[model samples]
Target: MPSPAFTDIQLPAPVLKGRGAIGASDNRYELLSRVALDDGWSQEEQPPPRTEVSFDTSKSIIVQQTALDLPFRQSLNIYRGCEHGCAYCFARPTHAYWGLAPGLDFETKLIAKPDAPRLLTEALRKKSYKVAPLAIGTNTDPYQPIERSLGLMRQVLEVLRDFQHPVGITTKAALITRDLDILAPMAAQNLVRVAISVTTLDRDLARLLEPRAPTPARRIEAIRQLSDAGVPVAVFASPMIPGLNDHELEAILEAAAQAGARTASAILIRLPMEVAPLMEAWLREHRPQRAERVLSLIRQCREGQLYKAKPGERFRGTGPVADMIGQRLRLARTRYGLAAPAWELDCTRFAPPPTLGDQFTLFS
Candidate 1:
């Protein structure tokens, strides 16, 4: 039988307990180092260090179609591997496809699309490009910490604004507030909407779960600022961890509603692929005492499994706990009059960016 430490071995990425890469065809390595103990010995290994980066070249800016039944159809990810480094991020497993670990690598290795604006403009100029709401920061946050230095997301938004195209954004960064000049006008025409994801209101838990992201208070302020500026602001209490953060659901919704959010939504925690191990490790390291209970509750919702990929049940598991959370969300939303978005963004007015060649053709 596998050891107790190996109970949850089905991780998305292989966790190398020692400092060496595992080869598919080789197994001649010696046993990893271990320490003696009174009853049994203990083993310790150092996790890999973080990696820094400059930019990531993206051939295409638009990620065309996704199978998920989300509201938006088309999406754009300005970056990969969020620097916000939320321990429970569902997007972490995506890094493994790039030959990187979903643990520190997902948080450290940065990817930016410097050509995002140019590519977006080019795509919009296409005759076949249908005009629907383009979503930003759907996969990874466009306004992650790197935005402060790179300013890539701002450029993409500028392109969208110039084209008069409809866009939707979801982010936890306060940086979006800096673009009020553009957002306020788009919002006036009902051309844009934004959702701020706030996981918990506890500053300490926020730090441990989402270390680099803005504080809960700052996210609330973001909603307030956007709403006051005529922008439709919504709150997303995402990935409602069962034992870890379920208790904060009502409190989070109340705080966001007070901050001017007119709509609210929630998603149960999803552990796809390698995110399970990465998150389990985080729980063991940060909240050791409650780790078992947390895992148990998560499995209870996931049908006795740590995760379930069923299309209908993935986003919000079906169980008594998940049902209770959904009920509470509905009650909170009703109480605050946040059942629907303050306004709907207009897509009928979407106009493609004009090209120099098109300008001459127009005059001809």
Candidate 2:
């Protein structure tokens, strides 16, 4: 059993607790320390510390191909690390590649690709480049809070509009509604679709687990707005942790079905690498009473491990508990009148935006 007070843990409390990860350690070493409140300490005497976010402009924006067997062929990550620090996010360990702590740093220290639009246009304009529905916001939420000011997602949409290319978006933020001007027309042309992830409908629980994400109501509204706009919309009740939000599986699907969502999907929670310790800490702090049971259920799905690395098996685990969850999802979808039929965007309509030299060709 992995406990929060495990001796090998190192990261600081402020950096990890309630923030996706629990501590920071590099390939080199991890800092281990004991954090205890003094006998004289009082709630009146002090308050919690805040972790400010910082961003960086990354050089590369799109990954040409994915090693994973996802539905899509290519994936673009507009941002590295996420502001909506969901405690069970599988992407947290990716921060370790940059020599940063996967816990707090994975959520607070973010990296954005401001150059994505230009690079995407460049890639699309290539005569040899093939067209496929490019998946956006796969690694991090492209419409996160910072996007209000950055407007990078809107810019990316503009580029896709210029080329009349196909795209599929996934997000938890209601902010996608702000881009209907671009998405609506694209939808009419069969050039765009969206999937909104609703983790749990409980407002209080969402606040504790997903500190910076939009409220569940807001995300549900996003599905409504998108579906109303002629855009194909789907719901993802993802990272369904046991003893936590798993009980709401049917309700989430039913609500999405009522909200005009065309289809629904789900995945079991994954706590790979640094994410395990971090999520364990979150359990201990937020739901200590059910912490052990939660971990036990997770283990039941994960083959008695924190998580398994196998490809297809990892998304939906094996064993009776996992099987029951899968069966329940199918039954709920059927009961709610949900069907995940293919919503393929037209690829034949693609055309490269004319270049400066093409202006002269027009006169000729």
Candidate 3:
């Protein structure tokens, strides 16, 4: 069997983590797979539970010049390689750029920007800095489990609060609830909005889909908590996998609405590079019967391919199947009374920390 093939499935329990886990990184242009010939392996051979893995990040926390399509032109990532282990994350391929496998390594071998708040403060203090609502948790989650100790996200929020910077955040972790004190005050000034990404309502399915994320019930509760605190909250029913969790779209939206989510959004599944093989392996293991059907539907939108990376076409696929998903999402949002919130965050309230130029003027 070809090493790069998505059909090269392997069980992900102890074998995949230890012996069978050896594989090529994405740089090799081959999605490697391992086979274990051990006999008497039971279905109970559950994968060893994941543990914390940490790495260091450089001083630059803010990524400037984001994609034009994004609502915010700048982004701040507190961490790289999310601990959530979401199977369908397009961000997986990014880990490969660090010479790491986008599979288990991307989830377990996490990285943190301890200097994020300091760097953000310095950046905000720059004379030429312009204020736009900075997007948080865009490329990777800021509220992953390790954040409990690191507190990098909280630190960044503190800087934002001090400077009155408008910011947007998205996370699947219920940890966001812990910061309501800061967020509520920021919300009062129209400086913050948050979107909680709830992938599936089924507890078992959520476990398989986003292994480390907070449960669906907890995410709903987070929405209610954030809304109750006077913070504007939105729900993201994202990466609607075809023939898979797509059926849960309306349910997730309705649940979020009932829980006080003011707006809702979703994206079609996007499997790129090593992510394609990784997601396929999980599908085969967990949803064998519908695996091929789901892949077929994905290809239907991707011009008979697993994925197309074009900016416009990547988020939502093109063909009839993709079209139907988009239309269904619109109808569901309307039916649930969800739309972009009426109020706006004020950029004019921005007060960048005093810069060197200000000091020079003071002296002159």
The RMSD (Cα, Å) of candidate 1 is: 6.4
**Model 3 poorest ten-residue lDDT run:** 15-24
Backbone clashes in candidate 3 total 1
Tens digit of per-residue lDDT, candidate 2, span 1-364: 6445443443345544445444443322345533443343243523433544555566555577755758898878788888788888888888878766677777777777778888888888778889888899888899988788889899999999999999999999999999999999999999999999999999999988998899999999999999898888989999789889999999999999999998889999988887888888888878989999999998999889989978888889888888999999999988887766768889999998778767445454
Q: What is candidate 3's lDDT per residue for 1-364, written digit by digit as tens? A: 6354434454334324321122333444447745543343354545563655665657666678746566678888888788788888889888876767787777777778788888899888878888888999988899989999889899899999999999999999999999999999999999999999998999988877787788899999999999999998999999899999989999999999999999988888888888788787777877889999999999998999999978777888898999998998899889998976545789999886664556435453
lDDT of 2 at 22: 46
Q: How do the residues 91-160 of candidate 1 rate in per-residue lDDT, one tens digit apiece? A: 8778766666666667677667788888888888888888889988788898887888888888988888
Alpha-carbon TM-score of each model against the true structure: 0.85, 0.88, 0.87
Residue pairs in steric clash, candidate 2? Answer: 11-23
Instruction: Give the Cα error of residue 25 in candidate 1, in Å.
Output: 20
Which candidate number maximizes TM-score? 2
**Every model: Cα RMSD to truth:** 6.4, 4.6, 5.1
Q: Candidate 1 — what's its lDDT?
A: 0.80
Compare candidates 2 and 3 on lDDT and give the better one.
2
